[model samples]
Target: MQVSPIGTFFGDAVYKYEAPRQGRLFAGHPGRIELNAGQNFEMALRDLDGFERIWVIFQFHENVGWRPTTRPPVPPKGKDRVGTFASRSPYRPNPIGLSCVRLLKIDGLTLYVDEADLLNGTPVLDIKPYIPMADAFPDAKAGWVEEQEGDLWTVLADAPFDAQNRWIAERSDFDLESFARVQLSRGNFSKGVFDSTRRRLTVDESAHTGVLAYRTFRIHFTYDDTARVVCLQRVSSGYTAEELQEGTEDKYGDKQLHRDFITLPDFRR
Candidate 1:
């Protein structure tokens, strides 16, 4: 009964909260799996590149323990918690996870990937090419998920927000635009859409403005309640001037990014 990782995943999701509920939703966020050398894993990876997608069996290394019942990201109607086996909670019995990630390319032992929901440095057990004939089941009934509403809010970004997001992404691994899309796109708006409590977000109906916290950064956006549309306006530093001051504590090691962020042409220093 022995198990070991064939490789390690390097991705932008530094924290658990940064990862999307599903990998497919995190499309455009790229990552790589650096397989161990001298094991002929490169040969193992041969012929895998042609497949557009692959099933990655990985380990949830950060989860502490398993919970019998875990709260889902978007809970079903009238159900606060579901059986651990039912939901894709990281706190599983064995901390094992499976994600179908897009295969960009393979360079030697490094497999370029995208749409990965696993956190940074996650251990990958194995990979298998996805077969559309064997996996396609569009007609399949999704149990609790089917009970939820199907409508999704359209997420847009203004010229300014787009500029700021691009700037930050160039300096860091995170992608604020995609993160916002995944979090704000779907949910029951009547019951506080996008898991406001867990995601640390607030909305001002009067002003049509909403602010979403993404670790050391803040996303400011405006929404049209009637249209179910969210338009990102700008990006800001969550840290105060004092916090970003010289010799201050850098809890997440990203204060420097914020320091330079405030200098954006439109934002005040």
Candidate 2:
């Protein structure tokens, strides 16, 4: 079989199958793909910032050959492996990869991105801007991929699937107001005490759907017309810490507990 060359990528892009199967993986461990050496790197990245997200078409420079069937990160039902075309595994006959990466920032020809599953220095063939009206599907069905959708944490909590091998640096500077707004929208709130003069809120959202089935966490937030402060609380009845500890267990039931929430300091800093 003869395959026409689409285009060459610059430096080998970062490969991160470690990324969640979907774009929501941004809040998780994310890496980058530096493109600047394959073929026409600068020409392809021109005016890329105009798009909030971009569809990156690239080659699986690492994939050696074809495979009839491959194992997807999450196998459906009783199926462990499916036809190559049925899944997005890089080990395919063509070995082509398509990723819609969130355009974080752009500098000249280099595009900094998030929610990218690519590896460091992976080759990029073509780039296309993403339009929400066309790219987002409010009623779209993912077929087998749909079964894999759930709480981003639960899905990504468990090695390759859980980022067990990767190091997650706790980002201490996440904007509290922004986090408070998000939590408030999810309807996780209850009135409480504040810095002595003002009242605060403890937001809690408990539902069996989406992800995090045994949900029991609260966000300590206070939002005014100006700013907001947000913190975390264990809300799983008598089981918050226990469940979290269980969720972080390794694939082989190791003792190392995966710290779920970033433990907040006792007194407000």
Candidate 3:
């Protein structure tokens, strides 16, 4: 049997690292699923708006190959890995994932969803309404999660960081604040939910400070291990003074963004 995508999801999450652990992590992030124009999907979408949430069946298009076992965010004690089927790792044999996203509205062939965790240009295989009565299994025992200690931390933005994040968000589609929370909230500098070693990050655990690279930008932050609180200090450009100049190459077509960013009252300076 063969499978085909009925639509595509477009959003600000362009990279895997940008995606939150779950859609509920950042409720402000929204996306649109544009179904195939002439496939009569409009009829299929009839009455879907009545539901508050929907199950988005999408493809993990960027992931390649499959792993029999995968590492989880909060791995079990004495073990760093778990069966792939037990975890939500994208490196699956089928490369398909089901994400429950809030349905805001539907216009023409587009379905507007909020708090989406899928990356931009994700191929959507199907859509299903979320029925709480049928889907709600509150007491279900999660194998490893039940055995491990609660591993969630509170993430915050400092005064300077909040201002910087707002300034950048107004100028571009990047939400460094939310990304930082999703990536930093679950783990410390040494061991993170997303794994700091795999990401573009520099950690100074001694000082409780670290810098996380988000695309062309960098986030400076501090963490209180005792309180389990992570606070973002500020955001800086990953570009140099020379790279932001007019004569430099615009590889990612974001040189202008960097140039404009440097003029933000020298916030990170």
Cα lDDT tens digits, model 2, 1-269, are: 65434333332222232223444444432444455455576776777778888888877777698889976544565666778888887777777789887777776555667666565546666678999988888897767866541122211122221221122213222222222222232221222211111113322334222211111212232222112222222121213346446445444332232243334232211
Report the lDDT of model 3 for residue 235.
87
Rank ordering of all candidates by lDDT, starting from the highest: 3, 1, 2
In the range 161-240, model 1's lDDT, one tens digit per residue, is 88888888788876889888877776644456466655678877678788888887888988776788889888888899
Model 3: how far is 38 from its true place, Å?
1.3
The whole-model lDDT of each prediction reads 0.83, 0.44, 0.85
**Lowest summed-lDDT stretch of 10 residues in model 2?**
190-199
Better of 2 and 3 by lDDT: 3
Q: Which stretches of candidate 2 lie over 4 Å from their true place?
A: 1-20, 28-46, 148-269
lDDT of 3 at 112: 93
Per-residue alpha-carbon lDDT of candidate 3 for residues 1-269, written as tens digits (9 for 90 to 100):
89999999999889887888678766777899999988888899999989999999999999899999987767787788999998888899989999999999999999999989999999999999999999989998888867653368888888888888898899788889877877777765555445654457788878889899999999998888889888899888899998888978989888888777778675744
Give me candidate 2's TM-score against the actual structure: 0.48
User: Alpha-carbon error at 72 in model 2, in Å?
Assistant: 2.1
Best by lDDT: 3
TM-score, every prediction: 0.91, 0.48, 0.93
Superposed model 1: Cα runs more than 4 Å off: 196-198
